[model samples]
Target: MKFLRTALGSAAVSHPAIDLQTSFTAAAQAAGLIKAGQQFDPFANENNFLLGAFIFEDVGVTAYKGAAPLITNKTYLEAAAGILAVEAYHAGTIRSALFTKGLATPANAISKARDSLDGPTDLDQSISRDGSMVNVTPTDANGIAFSRSPGQVLNVVYLTPKKATKGGFFPAGVNGDVKTSAGR
Candidate 1:
């Protein structure tokens, strides 16, 4: 918490945090995904949602990277391509923002904090500094943005590389097929 405040700066944390439970409930209701009396685990769902974003983005990219033929439907392949393009744009936007905010300082601090929680791994590379030198954006051998596999993502969420059913971001486990680390 203190690290978050320091990394994000005092002004960013000045206001009280939003009520995540209420917000999630309202969002579910608005989406017509939940009934008035239906029960839902907002905390787990929220964590799942956050983790799912990265998963979806990586999957979208992977779909276009020689896996396009796996999709029997041409329309679905096109949709996957579209999703990949959008995710790339979104990644660029985030990277640009981080660069503007001084990637070598605060962004690196936040990345270090995340790495500490997630455990050291190539997938959890720091925004600035690959080793002893500074690094802005991580790229593959061909200079393309790096992508993480589902297992790598689960490793981060579970806070360990070992197989896990639940822990870290998902204490009670995520919902559906992707609930456990083994599911990856």
Candidate 2:
């Protein structure tokens, strides 16, 4: 929560409809991902934290893509590209870590949970199948990893295919234009 507080600060940001620090904590608690009065433990919170990191990266990628056309400044565009690269790195690192840990069973369970919440979607890749470990990375035709759109990302976070305003990972809803629905 301290990280959230520092990143989002006390002032309300117009983009994320609610205060990110407050909404994120409330949503995580509401979803039982984190217990009230519990100390933050990275190892204990791995699943949730990874899920959050995935969502964060996806949102950033989508946001950057959406804003690209409107950005007339070259410097801003370059900065956005750098930021996106970092987000991609974060996502890839999480995916690799999960795979390396042989977390197939738990990853699949989490995938199923997400699918149920966001509705059935091909976008949700299970880390394992047929009793074997498998890669869960989203890839393009060349087998290269790809970024997800905001909506696709939300579908994973909300754990449902249906367009949701709020639920699952975000109880109150994310701030800005993203909200709980898929991004355009």
Each candidate structure's TM-score, on Cα atoms with residue i matched to residue i, is 0.46, 0.54
For each candidate in the order shown, give its overall lDDT on alpha carbons: 0.45, 0.54
**Largest TM-score belongs to which candidate?**
2
Best by lDDT: 2
lDDT accuracy of residue 141 in candidate 2: 74
What are the per-residue Cα lDDT tens digits for candidate 1 across 9-113? Answer: 433324333334443443343334456876434447433343223323333343254344555766556665666677666544454445554433434433443
Stretches of model 2 off by over 4 angstroms after superposition: 1-12, 15-76, 115-121, 128-137, 158-160, 178-184
Distance from true position, residue 56, model 1, in Å?
11
Residue ranges of candidate 1 with Cα displaced over 4 Å: 1-77, 112-121, 129-137, 182-184
Clashing pairs in 1: 129-135
